[model samples]
Target: MVVVGAGLSGIAAAHYLRSECPQERFVILEGRDAIGGTWDLFRYPGIRSDSDMFTLGYTFRPWTSDAAIADGAAIRDYIRATAREEGVLPQIRFGHRVTSANWDPATARWNVEAEREGQALRLTCRFLFFCSGYYDYEQGYDPAWPGRESFAGRIVHPQHWPADLDYANQQVVVIGSGATAITLLPSLAAKAAHVTMLQRSPSYIIALPARDAIGRALQAVLPRKAAYRLIRWKNILLSSALFQFSRRRPAAMRNWLVRQAQARFGPTVQQRDLQPRYDPWDQRLCIAPDADVFRAVHSGRASIVTEQVARFVPQGVELASGRVLPADLVVTATGLKLKLLGGARITIDGQPLQVTDALSYKGMMLSGLPNLAMAMGYTNASWTLKCELIARQVCRMLNHIRRQGLDVCVPVLDTDAGQTRPALDLSSGYIQRASGELPRQGSRKPWRIYQNYLLDLFSLNLAPLRDGALRFARRGETPR
Candidate 1:
């Protein structure tokens, strides 16, 4: 088996493959030189976990750190430490970017093609797991404005932050109101003369504590593993409850969230900058640890402007309202361009597999692809929650196939599979932009991609692997 990444998802998959199926041999192919995926790639200021570390970290490993919302460097170290401690570090082949994978039904194997230092590298594996992230690393979603070249100030995208670019005492203006823009405002305000966040619309923002006091107390009284489990579950349940509340009572949730922000910032700031047009959970809520963003605004170090950009002038951004926001540096923290399977092309035999044509079975494997599983995370909760479930399910599938003497297992969707929708349930701009390019999800069991963790825990881990939709067979024989 081959894993296409050394990130959190890949590490989780490797752990399950080693412990759950010790007899199976596996290798991890990493595109970059490091182990951490997103954490390693993004080097911008205030790069931290958007979700709490308790749920984002691996289930097997304990995040003993005091900070629940950890920085990018800490998360990167944690990933490296996990890979090192599990002895999977040596199994990772760095600088190996997988370009294409072809599944041969005759041999029931995937002929993986990759590039290593400008050289072609090929290998065959019975199972192929895609743990790479959903976004295109080579490019982020930097929308073309009217006058990009007219800006005299330095323009930098968060995806490709220049190490040498200094913002000390420099006026900075960050575009977009997503997680990246939220995290950057406070960090940049600390050094920059002034920081301004320009956004087309606002998102729901909730401030949480930087450290987990309850987790610390639990660790002091209980065993390490026990404490970790309790803390993890507490977070999981609380998040799920919040999500349900947001969905069931959108108006109430919106009011409560706005009130919370009003407490952190003044009523004026809350109404002007924090209140979103859409209801809560319409998209993923942005987490502001320790009320850093609120503090930045309250201290008059940073300001938020919700308006349409007319164009980039020589000194700053000219808005549609005829107001110009001056800046010495423009950081576009907009969002990522969604790309499936890390921009790697997937095919069945010689026929191209357009993901948009198939349904995502169990949120792990595709409808027409066999012997392959992808680690796509949830849009509502911590990413690793879904990734971990997918890994454990992959292990179970492998074990079941071996026990049943089966060589291939593919999900077959019938014509009456029922109504279908986009793979992701979010209304975010990035998801909406990739509307017709992504896969679909059915309205029925094992085919619908539930965003709830508890629901997936049962549907993925506890449910029967021999679900009728997942067909199995021996090589050269008709699928059963």
Candidate 2:
């Protein structure tokens, strides 16, 4: 077995595979020197999760940190600890970047070509699992604007945040409305002389902390397992109910959310920039602790400008509204472009696989692929939870294959009756732009991503292994 990426999903998959298939040979090929993928890469001041650690942490491992919303360093430590505890660290080969993979029909194995420390190496494995994340690790989105090179001011991207770059007593302009932009503004306001959040459009903002004091008090009194379970279910239920209510009655939800923002920012800020034109939940709501961003604006530490960037000048960014915001530094937190399946060139029997042409089986396995699976998580919920579930399912499938003497399992999508629209209906720039590359969900039970943990826990975890959509074949059987 060959698992690419030493991140959360990859580590989890490797741990499960080791336990389930002790006799089989397994290797983890990680491109970077470190084990934690995202947590290792993204290091910025006040870097923490948008979601609470209760739902974000692994199901098998409980996060007993004093802070429910863990910082990047804490998350990285957690991953390392988990890997060490599970004893999967020894099997990992760090700095081995997989270049390409080809399947030999005669051998019934994958010929994987990778580079480690500038030397080429090859490995053959019966199964291949891609847990490498979606974004481009090589380079994040940093587009060049006209006269950008002439700009004498400092420019930075959150993806590649410089360690020595200081924002103290400097005028900063953050250009973007995504999570990164929202997160940085409040933190910068504490030190920067003035901060301006320039956005092309507004996104829905919601306030939450690591954990509420009330939640903490209740947890202290309740039993450990019972407290974790109750909190998990409460969040799941509340989030689901609120999302459903918003979708059904958008106007009411929008009005209520707007009023909440108004109450936080008062009349002046509400009149100027607090109100958003689009409906609530149209895009992902940017989460902040205790409405921190609103409070920062109310205290006159930060301000927002709703306009498009016409171009970048030597001094600062010029807006379409004919306003030139002077800035000593500019940080573009625009967004990321989705690269499907870590930009892997997947082929089966000499034919390349187009992701859009394929259909998703159980939202993890794809059609027309043998002994191959990829993990894609929910945008609505914590990503790691869904990923952990998929990893367990993959382990179960591998175990079943070994016991049944099966060599290949291919998910077959009947295009005539099976094709349907996507599951998520959000206007995120990344999602909207890359809709063509995303996998198509089925109209029926197993193929859809319900975003409900209860449904997925039963369907993906407890369900039987034999499904008509997945076709299993023996070693000598030919492709039909």
Off by over 4 Å in 1: 267-270
TM-score of 1: 0.98
Q: 203-308 in candidate 1: lDDT tens per residue?
A: 8889999999999899899988899999999999999999999999999999998888878888437476777878887788989999999999988989888899
What TM-score against the true fold does each predicted structure earn?
0.98, 0.94
RMSD of 2: 2.2
- Cα displacement (angstroms), candidate 2, residue 227, comes to 2.4
- Name the Cα RMSD for model 1: 1.2
Best by TM-score: 1
Query: Could you list the CA RMSD of all candidates, in the order they appear?
Result: 1.2, 2.2
The 10 consecutive residues of candidate 2 with the worst lDDT sum are 415-424
Top lDDT: which candidate number? 1
Q: Candidate 1, residue 443: CA error in Å?
A: 1.0
Q: List the residue pairs that clash in candidate 1.
A: none
